[model samples]
Target chain A: MTMPSTPRPGGRSARIQAAVHQAVRELQKEQERAELTVPAIANRADVTPSTIYRRWGDLAQLLADVAIEQLQPDQPPADTGSLQGDLRAWLIEYFEEMSSAPGRAMLRDVLGTPGHANAGKCDGFLRQQIEAINERALARQEVPIDPEKVIQIVVAPLLYRILFANDTPTTQAVEALFERLTMPTKT
Target chain B: MTMPSTPRPGGRSARIQAAVHQAVRELQKEQERAELTVPAIANRADVTPSTIYRRWGDLAQLLADVAIEQLQPDQPPADTGSLQGDLRAWLIEYFEEMSSAPGRAMLRDVLGTPGHANAGKCDGFLRQQIEAINERALARQEVPIDPEKVIQIVVAPLLYRILFANDTPTTQAVEALFERLTMPTKT
Candidate 1:
């Protein structure tokens, strides 16, 4: 079967994106069972090893792209009119997604690659995602700070607990998080 | 050279732990340059491939074991009574350790392995580190809740931000984390 565009100029970006996503899905599946290689992914995506390499930096980068794409929730959590509701929904869903095999693999790949540690890129991307949720919280007048930082503070612990502490965010823990972030300061 | 070990019947556990840590350090160095192998690690640690595999479960497991060992930090931050001082010290030191190459590698290994999703292990390990500081805070009557829970909530974001968001905990951000967590509740 003809795969999508390769990572080149012209019509290649879309095709390349599709091919890369497919390759990532395949690699993620393999990662669940065992380690994956560039050749194996190339074969599955029906692309050449050189083509895959040329497009992405390496297997890690390719995997990273796929992981990021997939790691993002399909859409931000719906605005529930309250900051607590919105954050709860967002965090619980986000945590559940990260706990998935693909989600976990993507997290591992991102964490694995050293060059991926560009804070500006990571912050901008995170701020963007949090902004979407933040805007909703703002519209509802539920959030107290810039929605972006609020989101980071609210949801960050979920990802952290999962990745570092290895603890899933229990309902109690999520509520605790909500209470901690959204509470008005006692002056 | 012989390393320290616990006196126990299953000398295997301590031996294996040392081997795994050594292997992880070597592999991570190689991974930085994009070339790592079970054999290379085996050679560096002077252990047979069979021994490495037998002890750690697989290459990923061996990699994970080494990385996992680093997750447990040495001690908690000094509690100087003020939340800001305690948190800033805690976060900066913690992030500095985890944000470094070795810390990043350990985070990656934890994410790489599927079986490590158990956060209970992480919580227990971190509580010990956090308690060292939390205890100091408690002695000074600095915190409101259980020191363990406070530690978890306070430090969770730092670890989370680093591994998943690929961001470091800035001094300002650390302050924000403390401010939010330390805010008095409706209770």
Candidate 2:
């Protein structure tokens, strides 16, 4: 799942990319992804349709790009001097964001879009985030566990509730999940 | 979440119900749930649409009934005389079934149907199965753990892979998940 590179910072081309991404997110909030069109997005962003075509190739590519951008953390959660604290903070923030209206709409678009295999892209982003946190822990001389194990223990259940069960995870559920994951192992 | 009662055994009505259920499953394999209709099901089952309506109330109700029926084990996985063995066996079977074509179709219908709210029904069935296993473990004098905890460790990851990531959990992944869950916790 190779994601599209983020546009280079500070230029006319970068500005257009930003505007287009914002338009895509705003449109997702207003309607399902099935209803979005390149022309409509061009109109929303005040860019020409040919410009979007030249840049994005098609509607699916454009939507995929937007989905990936929304998933990237504004800034990765700050380190809290312990792996457990970092994980808890990161996940709590993630859960809260995912439960917000805009977040839910973004998720629906990513997951429910026809013929767009965005799950792998999302999964890759999750793996990268967990790996980054584990790297921080390793630097602090804390033992690093498999990021996959962390995902199974922490991220999977919260997502299961959100997508399949249509339930927002409670703070207590988050805490319980973290506790179970970080509990001392028996010899 | 009140699942329809399974019909009693050995009668003409039971026979019709069985035919209808079989028809539903076969049709699910053949087409998406959105394409299913009472008349179509009746034609496949060689029964009257009136019979389907009289018995199941609506297409959504009929579909839900079929889903629950398929999900219910002929007999829940046998106790392997240890909690770990029992859990591993149950989950491996569950993982295989859910990744099967029929199972995936049923899951999609249960999750994707508008106004169908089948999550509670599915959740209830899972909790019931877990409790039954726990009771058997307690009879053997094994310590009981929170069923919700077990769900988080075992079921959630497998499901997340299937529905969100589009990955059928590898055997290695399943084993790792179980090992993590069963690792002894410090007091």
Candidate 3:
């Protein structure tokens, strides 16, 4: 959640981080997880084995880090003036990204890490984005929906379908839920 | 979903199946997945390695089978007369079972197996139980909710929390969903 030991914006550190992550992205395209070892990744990234070991611990951790990097939001949620507009745009984009093949693979990679620390981090990232949307709604003098409800009502089913790698809902389906959430109800 | 190669009824085949399944369960409790090889399992089950090799092909398939065996429903869904009664009873039991540590481990085991065929099987098992509940409602002349709706409203959130391996909801939260699903609505 707190960046998971990622190096901050800099010269050499940033360059190496990008190189190593890019190396993983390419190697994973050809090799299975078991075959993608530290030395191999180090060689591909043009770094020594000890550098990877000191930074990421093992392939499992590195894969988790790379997947997390792919999933992180590079910008804040778009402000659409109304909660309905804001949530619909945000969630539809999410549905598109996460329902894609690479997104699904990254999700599995994050979840497959030992102790599920990456899963927690992924969850944190989602929750933070939802919180931002809710804050915007509150500032706009509109009632904000509960972030927990968003997790249950929207994120849950969306992710369930993604994880199953089939039976994913149409964008319109998630849009309907977004409409339902922003509607005035007896909550 | 369709038993996936499980031997049916009583016979030597069933005996062998039970012995192997039990051996896998016992070994899994003590050892990590990487260490539970075919020879080790055969030795523990008092069977031949060739027997396991011929039957299950490899450790991944065997582990999937054992997890499936452990997850299969041994009985039909309970008929509580009303949809509310039936769904609440079923969902609460599922929430309890899947929230436990061993249950979570078993879920990860099934999902971890390559290809995610076992995930589909697990989904089918759950859907069957829900279908049974819905059929009972129809027979009783009560309105039945859609099974897909049940997947979205209940199973999705339930499995999402279970998969994350932490922050599972309280039993009351799931019971409340069961209540909501059975409530009269303008669907």
Best by DockQ: 3
Interface RMS for model 2: 3.1
Fnat of candidate 1: 0.46
- Arrange candidates by TM-score, descending: 3, 1, 2
TM-score of chain A of each: 0.75, 0.78, 0.82
**Candidate 2 residue lDDT tens string, A7-87:** 568878889999999998788778854468899899999999999988876665676678667786666667998777788
Residue pairs with clashing backbones, model 2: A186-B184
Task: After superposing candidate 1 on the true structure, give the runs of residues whose Cα lies further than 4 Å from its correct spot.
Answer: A1-17, A23-32, A73-89, A117-126, A133-145, A170-176, A179-187, B1-20, B23-33, B73-92, B117-122, B133-145, B170-176, B179-187
For model 3, which pairs clash? none
Our model 1 lands, by Cα RMSD against the true structure, at 6.0
**Prediction 2 TM-score vs. true:** 0.63
lDDT of 3 at B62: 78
Q: Model 3, residue A80: displacement in angstroms? A: 3.1
- lDDT of each residue in A1-187, candidate 1, tens digit only: 1123234545656765676578767566556445577788777777788887777767666666666665544666677776566666776666676666556655766665555542224445556666676677667655444554454556666666666565666777767766756443323
User: Whose TM-score is greatest here?
Assistant: 3
Q: Candidate 3 lDDT, tens digit per residue, B1-187?
A: 1233757768777888889999999998898755778999999999999888777766656777887778889876788778767877888888788878767766766665446577777888888888888788878777777877788888888887777637576888787676556464433
Error of 2 at A117 (Å): 2.4
**Against the true structure, what is model 2's DockQ?**
0.26
Model 1 chain A lowest lDDT segment of ten: A1-10
